[model samples]
Target: MKGPVSALGINLLGNNVEAAQTVIWTHPKKTEDIGYNFTTTKTITREELNKISKYIDDKDTSANVLAGIATTILTTPLKPYLSISSGIGVTLLTSYRSTNGKLVSDKLKKSTAKSFKVKIAYKYRQTGSNDGYYFIDTIKIS
Candidate 1:
């Protein structure tokens, strides 16, 4: 959480396949305009975590602290054993002020951030044995 007048980004997924995320912020000291908002969605699969593109609603398209995000349709690879994925994000937004909590950030600075993630079940036999996979009960671990 940033502040009372700012918004926090959080994501929740159902069944680990679909995700609902919100990226909204605010300038706490602004008297007339102090809102920022954007939404991001993603889907996790057996092989990758895919970014679902989104845009701001028409009603909020004219906000001061503008929020815009875009992600390529390509996928982020997931680890087989841990079922996890990690990637970085490069964002450009009009940031707010640190002192007065004002939406005075005039530059569209490029901000790069990394995000880390998980997914699925279905079995296929591994052919051409490299190392004999050890088995415990019915589970296989190499």
Candidate 2:
């Protein structure tokens, strides 16, 4: 009987291998998700008014005190663009009203002690890539 001629009998090949398939997943974007606009109200207190008056009379050039007050009173996702300006504006408006006899000061002579409410409207404005800031749309005091 004749058999296959081989010094060492071993199979060199078997089956072919398949390559892996890649799949990527992503979420859909909505128009509303891109930005937001809203309005909020805050009531001013006598103590806050006193602080603003003190800061104004002291002529705080850095506006840090005003910024702090703005951050607390204004409603925004992050630091508002007009935080410092808003604080100073409100203080000046209150002072003007007091001077013009529109708003009367309390015993402590604090114009802001009149206990007025502020209504603020904010709109998100985009500046750079995926970056934005909230800008004041309107502000009303009553």
Candidate 3:
């Protein structure tokens, strides 16, 4: 397997291997058959979102335009925690509204308790002989 790392990035609960897809690899002879090797890596890690969230949330007000999306796909705990580590320039969007409407950008700046929907997008690249990075997003507050 001298190709890309083919790593798995996941937000887990407790330390159960069956709980999340941490890493998967294709069977040697069965090139097309993929299998998850939970025996190698098994640990549910947490993520840092205070800075990232505030940054993105704030961008919702400005012209920077947040790039990632919140997801209901993986559930951990209420304000559990989030961890994300991937190739540079990964798109992260967690906004209340789709990129639509003309309700005025300035108004978005001075608003509080702005509920947002979840959207997740990323840009990956396999440059040189380096393997791409993995990311895990969790909620850790409450």
Estimate every model's Cα lDDT from 0 to 1: 0.20, 0.42, 0.28
* Residue lDDT tens for model 3, 1-142: 4432334444566885432323212224322232211111112212223223444444443323222222222221101222332321223222112232222234433444233222222223322343332222322221
**Highest lDDT against the true fold, candidate:** 2
Give the TM-scores of the predictions, in the order they appear.
Answer: 0.16, 0.38, 0.22
- lDDT, residue 110, model 2: 31
Per-residue lDDT tens digits for candidate 2, residues 1-142, read 0211111112345575532211111111211553456666777766665554454444444566666555545523223222233543444333333333322234445343467565656565443554444444555545
Candidate 1 clash figure, as a count: 0
Error of 2 at 16 (Å): 69
Off by over 4 Å in 3: 1-104, 110-114, 118-120, 134-142
Model 1 pairs whose backbones collide: none
Error of 1 at 35 (Å): 7.6
lDDT of 2 at 5: 13
Please provide, for model 1 over 22-139, each residue's C-alpha lDDT reduced to its tens digit, 9 standing for 90 to 100.
1122222321231121122334321211111111112122222122121221112212111111111111121111111322112211222133221112122222332111111110
Give residue 49's lDDT in candidate 2 (0 to 100): 54
List of clashing residue pairs for candidate 2: none
Q: 68, model 3: CA deviation in Å?
A: 16
